[model samples]
Target chain A: MTSLWPIERIGFYEGQASAFYNVSAIERDYFEMWYFDNLGAYKSAAHGNLEGVEQGHRKMEAALESIGNKAREIRDISETERKAGIEPEPSGLWQTGAYTDYNREHN
Target chain B: MAAAVIYRIRYIVCLLSMLSLAVHTALANEIPAQGPFTDSECVSCHSDRNPELIRQWRNGPHDPASGVGCSSCHGSLHADANVKARKNQGCTNCHEGPASHSYSKSKHGVLNRIEAHEQDWRKPLKSGNYRAPGSAYCHLHDGDHDDTMSADRGPEVRQWICVGCHSPRYVREQFANGRRQLDIADLKLTEGKQLIASAANSQTKELSKLRQSLIYHRRNVLYGVGHQSPDYQWWHGQPALDGDLIRIRDAIE
Candidate 1:
């Protein structure tokens, strides 16, 4: 594979992999951003449903934390493979994403 | 002496023939993989010719902080009459899980993926042009550029796309409510930020938890509002901002 000069194709792949993992976690977490309106946090001040709010808050916090974990997984997996100095198997890349994309240039 | 000169000429001719064959072989191998290559090469020229695309790719959901270039989805075959990337297949190729699990599972996704034949993907992502939405319909739908005409931001971004199926009244109300929810969330986030910034022992382990919670969850807050919601179900999103804000308050005080 011919890595195009200056595109940082490996970096691009890392980013895509991280994004997919991140999105995957979001789906897994069920943290729907589109729907739902004000309730827990606003009412927490009045001592209304404080326990439920706290639990929801904690769950949301954990879900948010997973995005970072997903990104780290991509780097850890690829960095190990990259040290082997072998190319990603030809069919590895995807639109949801893959571990690497650019061709390693042969000078 | 004449015989010696003739022998040297023949040897030189033999060497030139071998060199020519090697050069021809190399070129044959080169053209098929690279120019015929799709993704990054698409950017090389487009970067110069259409910088805005580079901008969108860099800033939008598809690329996020990473890069998913033209050929990644579009493929290598470019010509006057066809742009396969414009089709949903272009997006679905890589989005088997992300779109497939989410939008592809939705009615809109099903109609676009399953029903709407002859949808003319080559046409812009305009509402009537498509039977139902695809990945680009709302996200990449400014046709050519995301912020084209310096267009309105936020929910109004999809007005043109939605107007065909929905009433103007419903659209206006939805945007109004959506904007209100976002404003409240943004204000709460600001409150949390201000409190954290003024806190004592900013670098301590105790504070780091609050900081991490606030910062990381803040991204979720933004994305939560910004992402496509299937039902836009009532009240599910507001509590997240509330929870983070409340956590910030308790930690700071």
Candidate 2:
């Protein structure tokens, strides 16, 4: 028989979820910076900078790798929890009976 | 000798009379007939139909004092006023100068190269599609057509005309903010730096190029030509563009 996961374990998963959210926010900024640099490179090329485009590409790849590592860490944490017989249940944070009832009534 | 003098005088009178008759005929031919409606008849008919247009024209610089009536600009008043006849030539007839000459050479005249590749000036050009002000836009704001009629006569009027598009706050709100929010659907940026990041991501290559071109035309060409203000063209325009380019470069790296 499978036992219910401890509250501390659930809290740990929630903490991991929060970290994932934070990482996503950082990734967005990183990608935006990459694009800005890419545009700068394009502008530079318009003038006479032959290597600007290649340099922009390299910087973008480095940013992507940094973001990718954080994503991998999230995946590893999830995988470890799954192996330990821990599964996420629908938390009251997202939905309550009020929303379901409202949807049901509207539908 | 007296007889010869009398004959010459008679010949000169005949020549003068013939010249006067030719001049009268030419003047008559120049004035086009207003279809079924006379000038007064036009006022009577359109007084109820499009009273506001009549009022706007009456109040404008083309008022009775200026001797520019409905027939002067609009040509012959047909059942449906023939709009094709009412060309920019009508404006050029009176407003001949460097300002008017530069208009055709300006970016506003050649808007077909921009987003509005197949736009017709006969109909109102859409506000969103318009990159720069044409004769119609400078004179008539958003099809109001009462700019000259309602304009305040002073230097401050330039602000009223230009601030419609040139204000950075207005541009950011209209183009940048909405586009940023829409482009990044899943991830929302609440912080100021993050919002700027989102905006940067949303910026397209085509749009950026178009905007840079627009700025060049607006500051360098349009403002100077339209207002005949040489100071703005050289002093303000080129420096502003240089500064903006540096900002764009620094924002990247």
Candidate 3:
């Protein structure tokens, strides 16, 4: 029968075989075949737990995206302000708590 | 005349309850005027609560000199002592430093604030109990569900986690106090993760080596993330397993 085992699966099967069984070649092949079938089951189970980790990663990504979007928007707004011939750059960058927030960039 | 007497009695009851409440608040905020019991009472219980903290305290330049106890940080008042006074006033009183600062900003403290409105804030802490290895209290051994917090059920397991960074004498003391078991592998993973977190948070030359070691540590990836390994790997005579050895090597060095 053809095996659907990938390279990673084959390596892991070898380790599992070495750890669990030290029988004849036929026995090793039988265990490897069993593991090959079981891999699908384990992968499905693992996906259940990975859902939360994936969600956490998405949240972190969202935070990064918001930061990037805000910076770009600020730059565009400043450029527009400059073209209008008002105060060269908007003082919003240096106003009030902006200086304290700037210090956050240094460390 | 009788109506005035009833009103006066009601006023007295309100005043007494108010006085009782003020006294409770004072007791909660008041520092212990005397040192804790020198006996192993603190260690006996706390060694079970947080053997890891006990281990750190033993070697952490406090044992031989001033001899800190569980009360030094968590305070001595039991839950039954007073309502709100049982929450650890001692640690906040003196350790207004980095750990306290970081902890206040941590998710645990935020959760604590939310829970403070409904439940007794000092329930577990007042009962000489500490949150377990994978508790939401810290990022040390946090597992799948972030909401549930569990403590080490075994005294030996608790002590074993402590001996990772503590001195031999302190380890022995902890072991004497119902902590006979030991596990180097578990301690290595727990401390290694904390080391990594500390290194990542603080940028200092002193933590550079720890950061390097933490970055390269292979077992860290699979240590708490998976099932069945941490428990059996320490107890059963199993060969050392590395989950992401190659990935860790590439990431670190």
Better of 2 and 3 by TM-score: 2
Query: Candidate 3 chain A — worst ten consecutive residues by lDDT sum?
Result: A9-18
Docking model 1 quality class:
incorrect
Candidate 2 lDDT by residue in tens digits, A1-107? 13565443210110011111222344544545455566767777787886887776677677678668867876897899999989866443222222222323432
**Predicted structure 2, TM vs. truth:** 0.33
Question: Which is superior by DockQ, 2 or 3?
Answer: 2
Best by DockQ: 2
lDDT of 1 by residue, B1-253 (tens): 9999999999999999999999989977553333455566666766876797787776655564446556566656554213465566766777664234445545666677776575766776666777776766665664554432123564554665567667899767556554644554455456556666766745666567756665555444344333334322112233444444444444444
User: Alpha carbon lDDT of residue B18, candidate 3?
Assistant: 100
DockQ, per model, reads: 0.01, 0.03, 0.02
By TM-score, how accurate is candidate 1? 0.45
Clash pairs (backbone) in predicted model 3: B132-B151
Window of ten residues with lowest summed lDDT in model 1 chain B = B228-237
User: Local distance difference test, per candidate?
Assistant: 0.52, 0.48, 0.39
Q: Considering only N, C-alpha and C atoms within 3 Å, which residue pairs clash in candidate 2? A: none
Task: Name the best candidate (by lDDT).
Answer: 1
- Model 2 bad stretches (over 4 Å): A1-107, B1-36, B79-82, B85-87, B110-117, B129-132, B142-145, B148-253
Q: CA shift at A8, candidate 3, in angstroms? A: 23
Top TM-score: which candidate number? 1
lDDT of 3 by residue, B1-253 (tens): 9999999999999999999999989976764334444446657765876676667556543453566554554445443333322333333565454334434544434445455556544343311233321122222211111111123334444444444445667756534422111232233334334433433344554345544543334232222212113322221211211221111221232
